[model samples]
Target: MLYREAGQFKTSYAKDQAVFPIIQDRWFIALVLVVAYGVVPLVANEYWLQAVLIPFLIFALAAIGLNLLTGYAGQLSLGTGAFMAVGAYATYKITTVFPEINILVVFVMSGFVAAGVGIVFGLPSLRIKGFYLAVATLAAQFFILWLFNKVGWFYNDNPSGTITAPPRTVFGIMVAGPRATAEVRYFISLTFLVIFALLAKNLVRGRIGRSWMAIRDMDVAAEIIGIRPLQTKLLAFAISSFYCGVAGALYVFAYLGSAETEAFDLLQVSFPVLFMIIIGGLGSILGSILGAAFIILMPIFLTNAPALFNLPMPTDLSKHIEEIILGGLIVFLLIVEPKGFARLWQIAKEKLRRWPFPY
Candidate 1:
């Protein structure tokens, strides 16, 4: 009964095409935002902010970027970490060279740098696709990391080979570096995620997004219908990389504060993000958030569950168990609901709309 929209009527095309056409969805989103910006900050402890909320927001952004390419554009990439690395290093370079510029501007510039790199790598997609395209991006994953690892200039010649986010402020409040508080960092990450997610939502609903979908469904048909494959595919790569880049900047500045190339390795960055899109739902923005949250929180739960239950499982055994469980769950979920958590959520909503008369 509560989920019914019987009285709501769309009188115009604009109303019909609204992002949240359902009043309940808009209200729910508003409530979520209010809690995230208002209540969470006031109540959350340091650990929750630093370890949970901040990482969830950052990873969700990255997952959304991947979803756009893999899910919407039908491009398979394994170089997510590489693109993120580009962003992190670019941000470090820009901030160091032009200290006068705002950090937020640096983030956007870093995204552009990653986009350029993405386009270069994406060029191979013109003639190759599917497994070949994935292999090409995998090559980028290794090559970019090697370049960053060997290049002393990229790290500003730091002997430790680590790039650190130097203290920066937004309107006189510290948001990065060692002195920055968790609340400030969380807020900054949340702000960025919210802004970019909105932009992504709109972008995916526009003309270019339609072109991407056309390409994804069938490139040959898309080309026959006047969609330029080269432009469509490359634009997907560029925008997707741009999102990953900004997420990388946030990962360093808002979360990690300092990181090495190893931090963005396949296991640490790429595969997990791919898993997020798979487990979250390939073509869904909300799925990215849900997948990220599940991936981030599940591990924490696994690690702490033994202690919480007063079980004396060994640390190494517990880790292996966690891996086994995660692997099993992924297989099980794939078999049961291949479209993922987002689809499950949609199904539940549909059922709710039917209520007691669900057929």
Candidate 2:
């Protein structure tokens, strides 16, 4: 298993502590990267790649951002949606203002903006922890969404209060707005996702990540061990926000083409992201991707199930069944494993590695 270092030799502490010491894990990751960055893009259908896969990647990136704060750092955040909006609007403004500027650059710029706002809201965590901190984050969720909706300038003077995606290209290739092709968008999204996810994985394994995990397990002990709670928490917020920002930019540029403030409402944006982290397994990057995929695909698969099989359409019945199934899955996962879906995955992988062996 990637998390284990069995039958491998380490001459020093550094080698022992390497992120992936086992040959099996290294090969497994190599194979995965090959499939993700190679095969999937080469052969996937446009509809599957665009509508479903791209959105799943975006949400997974967002979930990884949330996981860093809540799962690793032991702080709660309910306002990722708000931070994402900052990414969206800030990107919208920057791109529109500088028509000649590169669209890809806007993605990084949005992250910087969202990171600033994320830190401002994250400041409250210095004094509060647990539920109180989560409540404070909720204030941000509503306030920021409202701020954008009320401000006409943020919407670029659109009558419907939604910001429309302007047509843009990179290297003369269409990659933004409606005219962009699915394969083009998929590769772009995958490029960033792979880069950032690797960065996040490295972060958690490094000094910063250890500090967060220490803080999560026991703040008092971590403080005694010289981990600066305030400094570390703020860093987590900033970096976490950075990931959310990029994800937000992708949503508009690659997926939505245009977005409304309503896209980030508390019930729609905030809660679903929260559920993804919860269901995906907190503190695990791979879990975030898996969780986002499961949640995103559930409703889609449900709606299409009847049509896919040519079964009688029950309309309301299918919708209700989906709601029940979603709710039940969350409840069952929580009661069964409060640590989130990541833990279950850890167990599964361990079992796979230990197959044909006894405890």
Candidate 3:
């Protein structure tokens, strides 16, 4: 009954087109924001902020980036980690060269750098697609990582060959580097995620989004109807990389604080993010967050479940079990609900609205 929207009448086109048409949804979202910005920071300690929430937000942003391309635009990319590397390296270069600039601006500019590289790699999509396209992006993954590793300039010629985020402040508050507390890092990441997520939500609802979807659903038909495939597809690549680039910056600066090329490896970064969108739901924004949370928290739960139950499971054994369970869950979701968790959430809401009567 609480979820019912029976009397929330839309008197205008804007009301009808609102992001959250149901008053309940709007209130729920507001409450979530309140908790994220207000309560979480006040109560959460280093462990909660560092181990779970930070990574969850970062991966959610990355998953959203992948979904924009693979889900909405019907393009396959295996170079997400590469784009992220570009962002990280680009941000490092900019920060070192101009020490006085705001870190947030540097993050945005790094995304643009990654977007340029994405456009270059994305040219292959114009001619080839599906498995072939995946192969092309996979090559990008290897090549970009190699370039970063071999080039002394990217790492600033540090003997360790790893990049570290220099101390940075936002409005006099430390938010990056070792001196920045977990709470500060959490807030900065949360702010970026909220802003980018809103931007993505609006973008996917507007003309450009429609064009991408047109190409995704049926490129030949979309072109026939005047949607230029070249422009739409390239735009998707650019925007997707931009988001990934920002995510990469946050991953290093806000979460990890320091990282090397191995930090953005294919298995560690790319595949997991790809799985996030797949398990969460393609073409759905909420799915990205849900997927990231699930992926990030599942292992933690697995690691702790044995202790909670007083079982004598070894750590290595439990890790292997976690992998098995994750793979199984993916297969199960594929077989039973290919639309993924977001669809399940929508179905539940629909059912609640019609409770006490058969549809």
lDDT over C-alpha atoms for residue 8 of model 3: 88
| Candidate 2 CA-lDDT value | 0.87
CA-lDDT, candidates in order: 0.94, 0.87, 0.92
- Judge candidate 1 at residue 62 and give its lDDT: 97
Summarize candidate 3's per-residue lDDT along 184-223 as a digit string, tens digits. 8888889888898888899999999999999999999999
Please list all clashing residue pairs in model 2, or write none if there are none: 281-342
Among these predicted structures, which one has the highest TM-score?
A: 1
Candidate 1 has a TM-score of: 0.98
C-alpha-based local distance difference test score of model 1: 0.94
Which runs in model 3 stand beyond 4 Å of their true positions? 356-359
Give the Cα-based TM-score of candidate 2 against the true structure: 0.92
Task: Give the candidates in order of lDDT, highest first.
Answer: 1, 3, 2
Of candidates 3 and 2, the better by lDDT = 3
Q: Which candidate is the best by lDDT?
A: 1
Candidate 3, residue 165: lDDT: 94
Poorest 10 consecutive residues by lDDT, candidate 1: 350-359
Report the lDDT tens digits of candidate 1 across residue range 335-354. 99999999999999988898
